[model samples]
Target: MQEPIQNRKIIHVDMDAFYASVEQMDNPELRGKPVAVGGGENRGVVSAASYEARKFGVRSAISGYLAKKNCPDLIFVRPRFERYREISAKIHKIFYDYTDLVEPLSLDEAYLDVTVNKKGNPSATLIAQEIRKRIFDEVGLTASAGISMNKFVAKVASDFNKPNGQKTVNPDEIIDFLEVLPIRKFYGVGKVTTDKMYHLGIFTGKDLKEKSLEFLVKHFGKSGAFYYNVVRGIHNSAVKSERIAKSVGAEHTFDENLTSEVFMMERLESIAATLERRLKKHKIAGKTVTLKIKYSDFTVQTRSKTLIYFIADKSLILDTAKELLYQEKMKDSVRLLGLSLGNLNTEVKKTIVVQLKFDF
Candidate 1:
């Protein structure tokens, strides 16, 4: 039998509208105004939206056109990922100063296991407050923090307060805190699952807790067990401090559908250059290259090629992606093109040889 992990302290820290907040922080004129970060409005998607813009129903992954339609006064800024990464490094350094058990979810979010920390602090809430303050002082950005006994509750609590705030769900308050939480508020429950839950009359953590394991498994398959434990605040997933990156990729969405092989290849070359930059920055290489193509009609296809040796060269990545692209029988004009390098060298190295079909 596995040992139960009890009395653990976890803190989830998430930057508030990281990109948009950075923009406002750097530009005095943009403060307290609606702003969004993305590419061209004609053919781009919103990467992040400010709290002001969010009031007008603007959100990330929505088209820039739709964002502007929703909030006509919204200001759009292009993403500066390199600058964001620089700040992320600073924040991560602060996290390491406290504890080595930090698991980064993205550039803006991370989980820290601080039950026994470098500072010898006993109160996780105080540590969270100090970390948030340091991030604001050093990075000129606000961060929200959640303090709980596990990753699940900590992550959810971090979102309880917006932009610059913190929330703590202590051991004694865990059950009451979760019982009234709407099913949609659960961290892993997306729109499809939320709709499915509604149909099953599962609207809150209490409703979820009432279902037997067998009933939940029958409805949700493998992930059912995860839901069962999470509802009762029994998440035991550890914060992995040294998580390996799975892949390096870059994508571009064109203003118009690309049909000519020459033009499409140009886009692929640029994407390959971006991917190469990312891989080199991280000092990692992969044996497999995947070509992602999204057609004009929204149909998507991924074709991949695996090499004998791990490669990080831009030319090699581009050429391999080109070969994979040309081999596929495209049904429509390509609207987006992306390249990814996976099957990293650090893990059990398998070539995963993909069969090349000239006409399929």
Candidate 2:
């Protein structure tokens, strides 16, 4: 008897060293050479490194000075965000043609839920291959893809293959694939978390599965629940398009939480500045401003106000946040302060042409 295939189908598409690859694609002379995208001076950091540069230990977020030391002849170029964004939109449109269930992780990577696709294709592997081919042919760039029953496996499978490659993980092969996987390869397991896992003799997914939930939680706090689910290849998060903005804000947990109001207000001002910049960048306006306070004991509370009109002004946001902060009846000393801009109007503008098309 033949086993029925599951209806769930997912695809993970990721560009290869996106910024550096885009530059190399535009300039034929840069191909097969060490190239980096970022400022080249003393203080600048490397944003992306070519595969050639990767051989010399150069990587993104590493200081430009260190990157040059790693690869002496590495060519550095400034990022072209506008150009990248234009290309990203085109890539997203291509995914929409296949399926509207697209979740973009960044400008370079996205996840597609193709269980019910426009083409009614049963094979996800073939869909991935076709998408990759279209990207290469139309966009003049290469991409790697992974096809699987779920997002986690699909993401892992995509990385298994290198630049310009595709891979698929069948349901039958899940256990075999996870048995030999390193603990560090798991998502959300950073260096600090990985070190703690190693100390507890958790070197692989199989080892992690052996630990009790209580034990994992004792060490990893809230994230331990996530680790428990991921090890068993279980995740329930859906591919949602209309993702509501849960507290549009900026916050930073200090290396050492301070109690001084002067320094706290200074931090709040910086956060407000950043939020205002992001608002302008996204061309978004909001009607509510919220102030969040987290005390040393981890207890948190928020104070918010609904304003008369949409606002994106820097000074107005900071002043409103400061007023909200003053109104908070504090029961304990503060550890973290955050500012959020909410009630955003993100509705798409309906053009006359678009309306005519809709009428037709």
Candidate 3:
């Protein structure tokens, strides 16, 4: 028989509007104002938005045109990735002071397993508090945290309090907390899923919990079981400290859709150059090159080619991408072009390690 899961101390730390915040921190004139990173009035999408900008319905992934329409005063700034990485390194250093078992979600968010922390702190709540305080004091940035028994709940709870706040879902409160949670609040639920759930009258965790595993599977297919288990607080995923990149890629969306195959080849060449730079940065190569195409109508298509030996040169990548692009007839005018390298040479051999403890 399998053993039941024992309580584990998990903390999810997320920086508030990390990109926009970094811009504001470096430029005092941008502080307390609506700001956006990596967007323009005519082209591109908003990568991140300040809290002030969000008030006017401005958010990431929206078009720059829409962002500006929502918040006319929104100040758009170019993204400085090197500076963000510098601050990220400093913040990660702080995490190591508490625990070595940290799983980074992105440049601004991470999960820390503090059950066996360097600080010898048994209370994950207090540890989260201290970590947030340290980030603000040392890095001059605000962070939010969520403390729970597993990564799922902790990740969800972290968003309960925004900017610089922390929320702890105690063992005893986990049931009630999940039951009352809005279905849309579930970390994995997207806009489409939320709408599907709403149509089924599954507005909250309590409503979802009432459905049978079979019923969920019937409606949601493979994800039905996930909904059933998570509603009951049964997530068992561990925080993987060493996450690997499966592929390296770079893409660009053009302001004007190109109908000419010649134009697409020109765009592909530049994308290949960007991909080569990324591959060399990681000192990794791949045998498979995939081409991603987004049409003017918003449909996407991909073509891939694999080689016997790993390659990372722009010449080779561009050559393969060109072959794939011509391999088929495009359905419509192309709006975006991207290239990716996969089947990486950095693939690690998996070795199973026996678990001595299953507790968090």
What is the RMSD of candidate 2? 8.7
User: Arrange candidates by TM-score, highest first: which order?
Assistant: 3, 1, 2
lDDT of 1 by residue, 163-213 (tens): 699999987788889889999999999999999999999999999999988
lDDT of 2 at 263: 73
In candidate 3, the residue pairs with backbone N, CA or C atoms under 3 Å apart (3 or more residues apart, or in different chains) clash, namely none
What TM-score against the true fold does each predicted structure earn? 0.83, 0.74, 0.88
Q: Tell me the tens digit of each residue's lDDT in model 2 across 170-238.
A: 766666777678988876788889999999999998898888888999999988877776666665455
- Candidate with better TM-score, 1 vs 3: 3
- Write the number of the candidate with greater lDDT, choosing between 2 and 3: 3
lDDT of 3 by residue, 37-64 (tens): 9767566789999999999998998878
> In terms of TM-score, which candidate is strongest?
3
Better of 2 and 3 by TM-score: 3
> lDDT of all the models against the reference?
0.88, 0.80, 0.88
- lDDT for model 1 comes to 0.88
The pairs that clash in candidate 1 are none
Model 3 local distance difference test score: 0.88
